[model samples]
Target: MNIFKKNNNLFYLIYFFLYLTLITGFIFDENPAGGGKKDYLLLQVHLIETGFTNGVMHYLFDFFPNGTLQHSPIYYIIIYYLKSIFSPDIIRLIIIHIFLIIPFYFYKSLKLINIGNKYICILIPIIFFISPNFRSVALWSGREILSLLFLIISIFNFIKFQKNKNTKNIYLSFFFLILGSYISPEIGIISIVYFYKLIRLINLRFFFKLFFFNLILSLPFLYYIIFFYSDNEFNNPLLVNLYKNLSSFFSSICIVTIPFIIFKDIKKYFLFILENKKLIIFILFISFFILNSPYNYEFGGGVIYRLLNLYGFEKIIFIFGFLGFLNLIFLIKEKLYYNLFVIIIFILHTSLNLHFFQKYIDLTYLFYFIFLFDSKKINDYFNNSILVKLFLTYNLIYYIANISYRIY
Candidate 1:
């Protein structure tokens, strides 16, 4: 299993090269994605005319459209406070600060997966260069970027809790996650895994403790929503739609090879089952859960029939789809964070492509950090070298595409 044996040096060289490419792309990139130069100038003008608080409030509440209200007000206040106290030219400094936060995100992602390898940090800078959303984070301007920072902080604290098992870290994680949820819907993306884990681990005492913890911490948001928030559902400003939850499950079918495995290796797999007798029960258990899902037919129908109209090959799609679903269940059970993060990025790319969002793809780059943590679990296709190569190549193409899009 010497995965790095022959390619260690190449990996190291490419890793550093990727880091430089990512940084230079950001440093020289004037893509006007985030609060662009025009917006920055306008904010400064508004400040001079109306005074600081009014100007900031105008930008925060009155500036954006109906959909923009979903963004967490906490993010607006922080950005306003920083922009007001500092030079009017706050964009460059903000970009620099975001870049500096890269290391923290890198280290925290690895810790989340219990990966102690410090060298994995080398892969952090452009870790999410694969997802277009990440590229925009470097440019700065979107309040979603602030939400991303909160997301990372929450993830880091959760990982810290994983290692230390501290209840305090749990509270800290929830606190930041709450703050992030206000900033964007991205923070709530974590609830899928977070609540599942809590439900799995809950005991009578832990339940009460968590109940009190959530109640006390949720007061600020609850109070704010009731008193301060004027827009309905705060206009869901950050575009965190609950529908994105299904985005990952549906997108998992993108691995076409996994579905094909059913027909290709179906006969031999039975022999494999006999040899690994102990695993059959586990496999059956996962399969049971997969078939039991509410959207069982739709999940497979998309893959075999391509989601347009499910006419041909219904049974073939179902069997293969079931196998793919099983693998997803296995990943969820064993590699929770790794699988969940990939789904988050997949949904981010697939679900958030609004008409006005020119740079959401670039800004949503937080995906890379999580995707890289446990590289071994890249996909179920890793057993085949060609599929593995394809998976890697696919991700690299995304990275290159994002860099090209941002730089150009």
Candidate 2:
């Protein structure tokens, strides 16, 4: 008991130390790294407040025609209201407060699912904070982190509904999921995964009733997208977007799965590969086709591409991408349908984007791998002291590297 207490204290200390760094970074740095969309978001909020004085309907009508508004308006609308009540600095601090609570929410969700012990669950949020993107999004205001909070809440409610079969829990899950999607449309794709789970859990009558209820709630955002959403900014060919995004997406999966690799039994992985030779062969063929395709090395292929490019070995991204596919195969073999659907939906969602960045996938995939993927596997690895140390060290190094890259 004393040992657990001591370790728990240490974890709290480390969390506060990291938390302080985020606060300090936000305060001292004129332009915190990442959140390339910050300026545009703020501008949109300003425009909404100053120009759209008539009403929300006026903003919706003028949205696509404005051309300057790149994202969904929900976040901007929230910010606009907040600005009316508080100064800009206070609004930013409010966002940071929202950002800080995410770890606690993560801990709550983990505990709800019973993925790991208290100690392991505590460590999960620390791992979340270690991600460079987490800090970046926290220190700088953006929709991603706020959207993540709502999604985590949605996941929590969904887990509760699964356990208790409570109608209220499922309703709450749908509500938060829709709320998150409005904040960031990319997150909306996750609704498909949630819908799939709902289909199996509820009867047809209840399912249809629940579906229409959420659909009614979602109508405002649907109307916005139908009338105001524009893809004029993304002029690249659809095939080009797919090729680049797939390579980056798979590479991202490989990068975030490193901690799992570090502690997992390697022989088991190889054994699965050997037993599924046909599947292995199929993955190899697809990987090779992707590798052979003409792709621009200049724009995003994710961290693997950037790191390998430094050594003039960027082509190795394909190998990591191949490994990523194998990880998905493992998920399929384990019958983790919810997780598999989340990943598939994320890929499809990102593939349509104008550019792919490591920030888009790193923290998001890490969250899935830790909290949503194979729980027994996570427990086995997370319980190891060495795995915890190595994972933290790796992320700290990543954080430093990102800062240096941005500064230079």
Candidate 3:
């Protein structure tokens, strides 16, 4: 008895058309477009060819010693078998990474927020495709989407357990949280957020069991890290370049949060800014000190990093001043607490992935938008003049710009 079944058919038809459109694009793409996808493809193909046998994935230690072994063994093993049969196809990657997981995550997140309309739930994924970041990331054939699926599933189950006190959901959450982190530790930092609930639910004995099991699962990876660190960029005395990490983190945060200000009532946005002048100054000062600290990720150069190279720490403070100005909109006007997990996700994501985040911002930014709506508002406003034309118009323009933007 869903009220929006009529609209649901139209969206399904639209999605089917979009699916076909994306398939045509994929068909023409000869050089796999994502960052690190080709590398992962090569690794999987190599693993199978070179005696990656008998459940001993120790080849992870031999082949990807630069901490690439940090990727969960399951993904490579799965891909190895797939490539063995299918000859290293990109379509398999696309079906699992882009078409399957990303859209499902958006749907689940919408449902978690109590968005009930089937049509509205569907809108989240469609709108995601409009984003410039999505086109690039989906094309870039990486394991990030796989990690995102596990991350989202874990979050959902944890929150479900919180509400229902369901042990089954909690166990599933633990499994997924570990699996997701093993794939990409960046998104797995979400485990920290669940600590708030874990503290309330678990006794000391259960904690010991949880710790012991996860430790056993993680032991090989822990050993890999110790051996891997010796020859890596982090082997240098300075683990990360501080000024770079913070500024990059600040820039990425702005990308996800700035749109609310850019698209909304600017007068009120600045009024709140003007009202909170002191807080803004304080934030900039603090951001300045923070930017002086670690550059965490192994950076892949891009337009953002190039421009950042030209600016000084003073310039970074000035820019954060601008983002701080826009943030007034969230702090004063919107119910920012509703997105506490998302806000934390973005913060930790940027913090952890400062080096290579430019190529990967698509992973989490789309979810920020996915969780931005409620079912009622989505239904009411999806066809509104501003949405049907203006917003989508902007997103489509951005999408086109990214076509030639060099994903790989």
Candidate 4:
């Protein structure tokens, strides 16, 4: 009882309670309609109940011809085997543990970057954990969190490779990255960043050898796409999908960077905006005319789209999207090439998707902000306790609102 009086103990107590609330929410969720949790569970159950046979193999690899299998089969295959060996409850517990341990990985990555202040390093991951999407995905037993876990590990190893110039660390990074891509193909886009880094570090002969080696590993996925995949799964035309994804990408970036923009020196940001007024105006014009409002879609635009739709100010999405574009330009101007390449690759990958969800990019961008952005001004700003408090409060509100609105 006396230990609870200590500040660190109190903080841990609150964190535990918050995590407990998320678990409780998951346990009692009632498997809400349209959130996809029910489908995920049913798929797992189906996998567990069925024997591995020719039909099952075809169903998993061939995208079911009727467009039933929506995602890559690697994740389901692993889950199927795991469920065969253990109960669904055990799998859920494992997932929860995976989610719980992510912050420690974040702490290590931050430390690798020489963040120096232990408290701020700890606070950053806590802020990340408080994210509504992060919590919802974790609670829903979504595969995104698992894929993100692998991706974070990959990033950590990549950072280690950079710090120590260890060839083995780079190999480990690509290995984990490939594992992550197997779980969520979108994560494969990050390999572009890794490849870019390698180009500068390794000789051409070794670089090609490494590239082909990873390519060979990825051949199974490619074979599935070329021989077994169905085109009927995509309802939208390729051009329309690209347009919608690009708009959502910019708007989602705006939403993700709101805390950074708000907490940083406002005067400097305003001056930068002023200096780029013409470019901003051009972007807004293009956004207004070319970027269709995400609210126009019935599903999966992103948080900004939903909020704008809820308030009947859907047209203003263009402005927010433009602001996000400006933010990206500023970050690019900072000469963060690795970060820039990652964002570009992510956009290209998502451009192939028919819909864009905030969940897809929210945590990914947050990870980038925390570890890869590498801006001294932003780093200094993030170290402030006030920013952490504000970020926490914002996410708490978002979590409550997300629950109330069933915005999963």
Candidate 5:
């Protein structure tokens, strides 16, 4: 199991080289290569005008087409500061910032968990670089980047809580969770996990304190929506039509990864189950409850706005996806099962990716894989042999193609 016995150094060197290539590609495409040119342009303009003043909130509340509001102004303010220095290339720099944050956050999270091997972090950037769906966000200008940033921050705090159940750390986790919710309401689904952590205290005083803080934090957004949101939900028939099937088969596949992801971890998972059964079951129940809840599926009316509203839970799906893959990898590495069952299920999950989001999903899969792969046993197999070279080449090709697309 000496995964790093041969050429681990070379592997890491090339991995980071590819990561930089993707960063360059994303930075060069600042003019809107895809469908979000206008969004970036508007954000860049707004950043120039507003500085750090929270004017973007007023803008989104007043004129954003969907009447959807963002929760945090911190990222916008940061962008404003960057714009002041970069001037003409502010958009490009901002995107570079987003692209860079993935690796930065990835490194930080792993380091926090004591798994931050240079080689492991290197492999992660390589995997994420190959993910075309990540490129979609890497190229866009919106709150997805902000949501991801805050989500990673929250995860860092969660890991902190995992190690030390300090009240301050727990509150810090919840605070970032709330910030993430404001950044992209879709990511709010992670709040249930946050709530679970809070409720674990089970004391009435702590419960009231958490509840009151959440309420006070939400008040500004609630008031703004009630007083200023002018969009009429009842008037949109097309939205109504979409509401019914919002969580239809496609979303289910995306969120659940079907039978394989579900069974992948079930068959081989021993570490967490053996170590923390109660917490594991709690996660499972909450994950299922959120996915099957009525609000997750399309309702009968105001389909468009409501359809967008349904996205708030996707963050939960993302977290579960990470866990599911990690469980399978751990199972395989531990020799818990020497069968093809895990491979078969993952293939089935891959087969259903007709809409091409699997590549992006692979990012989380790879994240968990490399994080765990850095263990001493797995690192023993890291040979800088031909097989490793070929694997690294495959990842580099993905970066090359994406960079070529941006340049040509």
Candidate 6:
């Protein structure tokens, strides 16, 4: 009875931590404003005004077959409807982005895995929050995070359908995926993986029927692309830009791992790397030195292309990093090794992508809390040997110090 009660309490604590973290994140976003990448802020306001006054909201938000807008009309349309009712401030938009949508999807993902126990459940978002290069995604009131939230929610609902057997959740999941795809095509690709997972679980007849149905449902958005954006600014030149971006995405992951190259003694440092095949894949995916070469032209040109590519690579790093860390925790008997690897991965991943570093820094408190109560053998080692603690502490501090070098 005591064990069961303890388990229940842990579950409650996990949920409570999620709520607290999101509230803190929202509170921190008090002024929420950006100018360079978020010029869409003014564009959204213009669309709302055009809709209210000229009654041609669609045209104003449309592609215009020229170098007018880089994004799709769906996001603007949603804002237009929202502005129809309440005053649309950037803070409110940001609160909605970070607090409502992002955290909810994050909680749902953790809950789906059935690890809602306080210690394990909180690790999901806390890890992501402190991950490097995550600042831009967490704070920015843009289509990317919103679209990602929708995509993840769609996956959650689809997973929920397996147990509830509710047609509604599946339908809603499909709706969000279609909507998210219309907002961000990269999200569309990620959504396909969820759909595939769903198909693998359900019976065949239902799978094909719903699959083709959603595919058809999303086809209309292509009409806007075909008719409106065919001759737009994003043509062959944009295609070349995207190609260059693909190269940088590959290069960033490879180049960033170069620092560890000189540290050949990491074999003694990361037990997680030794035991997990998943960790091996992750290391390969994000280690920049693994992919970069002297003739790497992909790293030097096409800034916008590199920016887009970085989004996909960042997602890969986050998912794999989390997976790798979890596996390390289970296998490693040393607390120092786990803490050091976590710190190193966090620093290396974020240092190169300072623009999005907020995502990783937000979880610092959670990690510190975990480290305080760690049960690994390395904890005893640290307590018994002051020199070991000093050495590890110095390395961790150096990890943070080098992050400044990556900041351009």
**Candidate 3, superposed: residue stretches over 4 Å from native:** 3-6, 30-58, 66-74, 90-98, 116-122, 200-216, 226-243, 286-289, 292-303, 307-346, 366-391, 404-408
Which model scores highest in lDDT?
2
lDDT per residue (tens digit) for residues 1-408 in model 3: 554555667666776776665556556652222344455446555555663664444556554454433344556666666665674555355443454565665555545555545446345545555554454345444566567677677767876776788778877877887787676766555555565447778787876776676677667666755675335543333225323554555455455444445554457667866888898778767656664343433434233444455573334443653463345335333445535555545555544432545545545654444432212333334333444444555556656655555552
For every model shown, the clashing-pair count is 19, 0, 5, 0, 18, 19
Candidate 6: residue 347 Cα off by (Å): 23
Winner on lDDT (2 vs 3): 2
Question: What digit string (tens of lDDT, one per residue) describes model 4 on residues 1-408?
Answer: 322133445456555776786677667763322354755656666644553445467656443444544567677677767766887777876787788767657756866776634255436445545666676567666788678888889899999998888888888888888888888776787787778777888899988877887898888887776677646654576567777677677888887676666775567778988987898788778888666544356767777887788898777777878888777666556666755665667677656667677876766776666565556665665567777776777666766676567654
Q: Give a tens-digit lDDT track for model 5, residues 1-408.
A: 343334456656765686676567556663312324555665656544643354665545544424232224445555665666776455655664666666666656766655533355444555455544455556654555666667677777766776777777767766776786665443444555456555765577977887788678867755654565434342334233233222232232233222233332444345556776787667566555432323332332111223345776443443343354344444354533422343332333222211222232333433323332223433332322332344456545654654466568
CA lDDT of each prediction against the hidden true structure: 0.49, 0.70, 0.54, 0.69, 0.48, 0.46
**What lDDT score is found at residue 42 in candidate 2?**
52
lDDT-superior candidate, 2 or 6: 2
Candidate 1: count the clashes: 19
Between candidates 1 and 4, name the one with more favorable TM-score.
4
Model 6 ranges with Cα > 4 A deviation: 1-42, 45-53, 57-65, 90-98, 115-117, 124-140, 162-168, 235-239, 251-408
Lowest summed lDDT window (length 10), candidate 3 = 371-380
Q: Report the lDDT of model 6 for residue 291.
A: 25
The residue-by-residue lDDT of candidate 1 on 245-267, one tens digit each, is 23233333424234323433456
The TM-score leader among the candidates is 4
Candidate 5 to truth, TM: 0.54
Pairs of residues at least 3 apart in sequence or in different chains that clash in candidate 3: 34-140, 241-295, 242-293, 242-294, 299-355
